[model samples]
Target: MTSTAPVPDPSPTATTPASAASRGARSLARLGVHVVGDGVDVVVLASQASAVDLVLLGEDGERRTGLLRARHGLWHAHVPDVSAGTRYGLRVHGEWNPAAGQLHNPDKLLLDPYARALTGEVSYVPEIFGHHVTDAAATHHGLEVRDDRDSAPFVPHGVVLPASDPVATAERLAARPRVPWSRTVIYEAHVRGFTLLHPDLPPELRGTYAGLAHPAVIEHLRRLGVTTIELLPIHAFATEHAIAARDLPNYWGYSTLSYFAPEPSYATRASRDAGAEAVVAEVRAMVDALHAAGIEVVLDVVYNHTCEGGLDGPLLSWRGLDNTGYYLHDGGTPARYADVTGTGNSLDFRRQRVVQLTLDSLRYWAGEIGVDGFRFDLAVTLGRKAGEFEPDHPFLVALASDPVLADVKLVAEPWDVGPSGWRTGEFAPPMHEWNDRYRDSVRRFWLADAKALAQGGHGTPHDLRDLATRLSGSADMFHRFDRGPTASINYVTAHDGFTLADLVTYDHKHNGANREDNRDGSDNNLSWNHGVEGRVESGSPGSELRPVRRRSIRNVLGTLLVSAGTPMLTAGDEFGRTQQGNNNAYCQDSPISWVDWERTGWQDDLLETARHLLELRHAHPVMRPTRFAYGRPRSNDPFIDLAWFGEDGAAVEGSAWHNPYRRVLQMRRAGGAAANPRSAEGVAAPVRRDLLVVVNGALNDVDVALAPSRTQGWELVWDSVWESPRERHESAVVDGAFPDAGTVVPVEPLSIRFYLSR
Candidate 1:
């Protein structure tokens, strides 16, 4: 829980050589390719290279190479007469000892990790690999060999960005939508998938960043009440060799190549054809447009590892630059990478240069590109120092302390494949974590529990206590470290797993199209098909099944929105979009992955239900408590912040929490007392309405007695039983008000109800 000291900055300094001093003096005090004065200054961190050369490709296809002066682990040079729009790459000459983790080859063109814009696509051919064609067998056998083939024809080259106009950049930052964390409702989406099928967007703009900024897209997000759009990785990434060979792309974009550049493919074809600078401007325009619409943008960044796989992988940017310094190699054998991320190689956070690179990339995106925050993919690896995850690792501390980054949102995935990597709720304060436990518990409560009940099971596999804990902000996991409810990003479904529609439509994943023969994705999905597997046609013989499935979806959505935490809704889940039961659709980039604008009658209803749930969340602050509710009123206060009760209107106690058969529970939050809750700064905050949420996980309808309280009356505000929004809202208000105590309420089977106390 203690804060770690900030890592000291290791700025590059000039050495005794006059050339090094001259180059350092002229270079701007920033990393990457920058236009300084009359020439472009290139700075690269090549710690272990014997020689570093700046290779430039002219428009006429002429190639020129210049040696860079090295000093203190950094290579620096000022190329005269060179300006922005110049295409460039790096060539680091070093030993080819694969056993010792050195796979440098000057013949293989390398990318600049700090490249602001990258042009061309990486053609994954055998020439791209570092090992010789004949010695390729040796690589399989764990031996090192050099490949003499040139990779210049197939590699992506960095394009020097035009000098950033400080005034323009400032204006863009000034226009950003700095949404507060407490008010943030993140909608995790893909830059391409989100608008790919939008009927209103122009065909050219579809699947591009510009398309995401279209008015129709903005209106939809606004209608759904999303504060931030957490985009899937748009960083310049390479399709994995195997996936590409199979004619499949890395759709999720977890494999990042150039951290600074936006993926050019996400830009319009016109922008791409115009070159990298145009692509950069297109992304900026998207951010600006979203900001104008009052929506913050958060990138899902992959800093845990690079596109380069293990020793047998291609010699891309990092692996060829300085393998030992950039990546963590096996302790016993330096040649092999320590695969903590299951991505072949984990970035070495122990090295200051690697840490600097990550920090620099973050700052560039936040500062230059005008992004609001980042959701780190496989974030646990970033906190791993000396082979174990630490809450206060130096890199983490630096991130939390950085002037530019500290104010922005920092969400962590919170787990990896490394030893003891599941550190959910263990990260330090200000670091919100994705709550997988919450996802599982909610799924079990609604979907799995219903399935078990239909199978003649006695009760749920687990009691309602876990569900209650998660609904009340997961205090057991986060509160020990003084983190508040907002620290837990509550979600029922994310992009990695089954969609909300699929959760109630399929019991098992249908991943046969992934070419893995239905073996990929998680087995323990906690999903239930609700009496029928796969998609069930409307008006089928099993007509009752559709109603059950729709109610199940509402149950999960209600729990997520009414729960105490920041709620994140997957993009297509709002309208019941499904990948046809494909849980792991990371590689399916076709129509299967895109958000179809075409909707069924049920889908429209589902979308309306989702909107209503989000509206309720925003209207009632008790559902999103800033602090953990302990069921005790403040000093001399007549109302309790939160209280739980049983079906008989009595306080829940003892085995009642462990009773699996007891599926009905009532929770009441003190609206009057919460009207003016105290803020962290000790200021009197705005008043929030008190609410009572009733949940019934049983298969049959039951009468629930309202909990005894001092409130004057309770009015039914929302119910999940309604099939349409008109039905839900028109008959939302109960005819008669209930007394403070001893009132039996008719609760539906497997549904939730919300009441506002007056």
Candidate 2:
């Protein structure tokens, strides 16, 4: 049970006024307190309390106090003088009962629900924890009844602010750097890691919000051609008890402390001194800067759980405001929480109030913070019911229907730690999901069978087709109704798995650096070490394996760029930054996870490959369609966007998919009529065109017969092995008139080729 030691006399500076409402509020805010309304019409509601006091700390550090004394069954108080920028907190008096979830003690301070700004971090000391502090006090109470040294100094203080419209902010941001879903290339990065090691960033600005907008960082992003920068969580967070004991902070910021407050550590000098407004201004400035450069900012949000732990956890904002109401209470005991996020307590979205709070928080961030979109962490759990997570959960529907959020990109991680956690491609339309299937398929098609190729067995054509579908946005995964193609957020590697460099360098997870008994990273890595692990091409330049690695990187990147859906590139992958094999570098905030801007010789080559691929994707309108054109009449474009052909120029069979020995895929892209309605008169439209993409995974060179083309002569666009501009394919024309002889295109082993029909 929570019992506070006798409260020490308030400092004369914080003495309360003797008004009746103030006295009454001071009497009733002790138990089950709920405060609502903007400044000047403050209404404090207390369910069980003897006394309550409303204390307001001004910007000048001076505090004013008003009492809220309990009366009848409900204790209510109204203060009309309160206004914005007014910092307020409550002190309540009531019976402390921990087992019954009524942890109330008049001696402790309470934070207001509608608080706009927060002052300090939640201290994990004994004063903050209910049982820990009270138990320690009980032993001292036995020794001396008058020794009232209760620790009130550790509690978090809330700051009040005048209400403002969040919608206006969103409207201003709507036109800023909004790339269509097709052209968008997302670069997922950590706010701190993005520039922590940058030499150009000032020592003071390094890793801060200001650092993100620094010229060097911006220039680097521009060079990479990323349309959107998806930052890892930057919300205020708290270190868990176990992590704190180990002296490690929550680096990822997933364990949220306050949704409204930006992580204080991310801010610069002005933000720390000027409070939450400074944070908003600085972050908005960053967004504005990115918008000028045609780049969107997508925040990785964590709303499924809070930093507050389970039963023994500290009574933070939600716990103190309404313990049993805000969290999912266990059926066996309403006092305890139903843990689902694996972060101790799960928010009860089933509660309408909790749902409202979540919706409000999203609006606040999107509208005020000026983010283009949000990537929900463990999104499935946010909509979880008794068994499975529903697609039509109230929260999901609200987000889909809410005008402010509906237009903004709503991507989901799409799974949790519960039953059926691997719910990929399940989210509704206008939403993109991380396609792990694409990651696995790309990895296996290149690296996994390379070892077998050395033994003279080429990988299967079925394997090639599987890779083909992923490259075309895995239509098999999504439904016809769910905005086909864009529904899949395709990636070969993401934050949780092996990085692009590691995916080629290591076959196993190396998480020894996590300091958690090597239990952190994943083991299902579909990587191959290419004869030697964690090193490039076995220390040989221009070796046989070098082509394989280069071709593999090119294929994955080219596939991602030309694919139907949006593509995401992990930060620093373009430069081939390797983690030495460590997949879970979440704990290691040093160079292990940070992007090394300096590129090696091989890295520069890879970067060039990526740049050329991106240019090619941008040049082709057929690659990035607004909708799946191949699907049906209702779809946008006419001709099937992509068509797969087997070795003899015939349709691939479904049963041939599992054969690993066949590894050559001929992919065709067909162009269609434009979306403009003015074409009714059959104006001279662009010629019907088709291009061929050939991938050969054999260890030795092979000959790919070019299919007879009807359009003008083909131009060589790309080849994996040769340096981009220097690589070109030209041959004698092969048409039906000259069917007696066919053109033979030399295909390099473990390489990909692109031919464009002019």
Candidate 3:
């Protein structure tokens, strides 16, 4: 039951027509359902509609209708008696032409573009389509035939929420945990998957917002040293019709339905049953809890397109309100959508209305919901204007200049499936991009290269130079744009690909369960299954493969944490989580997609190594440099920022960078100088400790000569080959008994080591 408050009536006053128009325009600025004064003002943007009706469904099961007054492309109606929790929807009456891109179906109840909450879930039935589906084959062949069936029964309605709702008026907002970009360690996680199988979380709270905020979850993240939590899309989304028809769900939740509302399914059943306001309140509490723990939250937002798929898609919010205005349509045939995001349609950022909607949604989430940042899914599509991506596009410029959003982090996936979509480093400053080059290089060095060596060295495509560039923040890709190393969000694996454990246990993807006949996932996984495939039980014939795979996991985790950029770890990667080689688990809602809390002895060691690696990263500033190294010492500086050395303890030069057989290199970083010459406040920065990193990707252990540097001695701090995280091995360094510059130091095969210089 919803509680209602009494609404005050408007006072009668005489006004000129000009004054009335001015007042209506001012009211138009506040779009969607808003509790104004004492009444509910419902606003809908239907520029081409001849008439609009506000349909209300009362709790008594009675339906009431009210006509809206149209002024300047906006239809608004203020119901003085209607209070908060009023259920309503819009019915725009206009020409229902399919060929000309005017999809105004009066019989179908349309959802508001700015609706804060939805009453129910969308049921995908034939009535939801604007065109009738007489023959399924004909409909699938792109035939357009108008259907007169009403869609109110299958579509969800919008609910009016009061301004003083609990979610809107929660305890005073907490200050954002403004973790610096250099120190930011992102943990990409699914709100449900992260807590679904947690043994410590209560069953009812598991897979819900409250579960993510539970003390157990917070303690784990804090111990792991992750400063930010990047959540998959939590916006109200509907399962893809095709996937749902196959009894599968879009578990990733990329198909958004409502941008402002939190996905109600992610909330506890009790909160969901209470009302939409309860769901919002629950999400608010979770954000508050995370903030209190000094952890920032970043949402993966999908604004490139919507749930309403291509030309034959359903009549959801944007498609029904203004099809051509909201989505990009083919120039030759306006009825067909220009599919850029591979989601059937691409949002037309060229339209100011669409841009305004995106801005409004972002502002609402950042200001009201208190998210610290956003990771734009298929972000290149957002920068597309005139069928090409522009760095200074109006939408991009507006976002960069927005006062409220300027301070928050902005990350982009940086590409789409459209033309010229592989934009790895083209995004402007203040907008960090996911570095695919870094991901591929790391995978090749640790997994694919090792596999090549095992296969008689026939496929060694890269060498140590490639790994060096990625380790130093891929300056070849990002430095040209004046962006520093911090602009790179480096990760070896993410939600869309293989987990850390799977990288060394599966050479190919096992996506047969996705109903695509095993042809759905990517073919180029860049993985290796060591000596055997899949899980190896204790005492099995290939039992030795397990230890090898564990070592590979440790090496990858060590490299990722020590790399010079902002590192992001997938939720379960720190604990050796695997999806049974199922790289694409986007449709599976079972254990195949959930994070298993169960662990083996080796898995515990991996987790401990990951924790220690993150702590090491935090302790040493050289590992997370803010600026790209130039390999030359400044005039006033006592040491160079960075230098690369080959196996002979000499600087790598000439053709050595391209030598495929040379897979061993050492990096010396002069951490005594500031990672960035200047601080955020334009002042001189403090000096840090110097350090050295050694990586050997060869199949056999080799003796590596220590490079000459301006340090008295070097002490071994960490080694990836160590079986246990608690093992003390400082005696291996023998401090102050310095070896000559050309003296050899034995390095384990396929291992990485870190040393602190004194």
RMSD of each: 5.7, 5.7, 5.2
**How does residue 600 of candidate 3 score in lDDT?**
87
CA deviation > 4 Å runs, candidate 3 = 1-22, 61-72, 134-143, 164-174, 674-687, 730-743
lDDT of 2 by residue, 1-758 (tens): 24543433433433234543554455443322223342243334444444455666565653434443334434344455565555657655544555566555444455654454566776656666544444421221111111123334666666654455547664666656667787888999888887887889998888888899888888878877788999898777777665665556677778877676677778887787987666666777777778777888898988888876775666555665456666776665435667777777888778766676678778877776677889999888778776468878888888889977866888999888867877887777666788878877777777676755664554432356678777677888875455677778888887777778777667788887777877877887867766566665455753555655656777667667766777889988887877778887766676777777777677787887787777777767666655554532334445456666655556566866566677777777765654463466967566444566777877777776665454645556777765443344222232222221125666778777676676
Worst 10 residues of 3 by lDDT: 1-10
lDDT of candidates 1 onward, in order: 0.83, 0.67, 0.82
Candidate 3 per-residue C-alpha lDDT over 526-589 given as tens digits, one digit per residue, 9 for 90 to 100: 9999978888899988998888888899899999988888999999899989998898889989
**Candidate 3: C-alpha lDDT:** 0.82
For model 1, the superposed segments whose C-alpha errors exceed 4 Å read 1-20, 25-29, 134-143, 458-460, 635-637, 672-688, 729-740
Top-TM-score candidate index: 1
Better of 1 and 2 by lDDT: 1
Off by over 4 Å in 2: 1-54, 57-96, 105-115, 133-152, 161-171, 451-465, 536-547, 629-640, 675-683, 723-742
lDDT of 1 by residue, 610-712 (tens): 8888887777766678888888885635578889988888989998898887888888877545444787899876444578888998889888887775656
For candidate 1, give the lDDT.
Answer: 0.83
